[model samples]
Target: MSRTESVDKGHGRIEVRQYRLSTDIDWLRELHPEWKNLGSIVAIDSERLIGDTTT
Candidate 1:
C-alpha cells in the first residue's frame, strides 16, 4: 500500500486531497477471476474549507 497527500490554499479556500494505491490484489483476483488483468486499486479522499464551512 502507498499513500500521498496534497494541500492547497487559493480563492479563499483550503483544499486537501489524499490518495492511496495498492497492488496487492491477489485476493480480489482470486475472488473475481473474470476481472481479467486486475492489477491495482486506488482511492482518493478530498476536503475543502471555505471560511467557517467545510465540505
Candidate 2:
C-alpha cells in the first residue's frame, strides 16, 4: 500500500523526506540548509488527512 509522512519544519528548519510525489528533494534541501537531517514521520493520511494526531 502507498504510505505518506510529514516532516515538520522545526523553527526555521524545513520538512524532511516523504513529501509530495511532485516534490524535489534537492530543491527542498537547497531551500533549508539548516536542517542537516531529515525530520521524523509525522503521519500517514490514508489518501487524505485522517485526524489531528498521529502515532
Candidate 3:
C-alpha cells in the first residue's frame, strides 16, 4: 500500500489532495503486456479553489 498527500495554501483558501495506489490486482500483466513490472496505473486531476475563474 502507498499513500501521498499535498497541500496548497494561498488565494485566501487552502486546498489538499491525497492519493492511494494498490498493486494487489491479479492478471494485470496478461491483459496489458505493455505494463511490465507495473501493477496498475492511476491518474488524478487537480483540486483547487480556482475553477474557471480565469484568474
lDDT top scorer: 1
Q: Which run of 10 residues does model 3 get worst, by summed lDDT?
A: 46-55
Model 2 segments more than 4 A misplaced = 1-24, 39-43, 47-55
Model 3 quality (TM-score): 0.49
> Which candidate number maximizes TM-score?
1
lDDT of each: 0.96, 0.45, 0.67
Per-model clash counts, in order, read 0, 0, 0
Pairs clashing within candidate 1: none
Q: Per-residue alpha-carbon lDDT of model 3 for 1-55, expressed as tens digits?
A: 5778788888766576777776765677877777777856554445766655422
Clashing pairs in 2: none
What is candidate 2's lDDT per residue for 1-55, written digit by digit as tens? 2355766545444444453343235555667787546443233233222243333
**What is the alpha-carbon lDDT for the whole of candidate 3?**
0.67
Residue 43 lDDT (model 3): 47
The CA lDDT at 54 in model 2 is 30
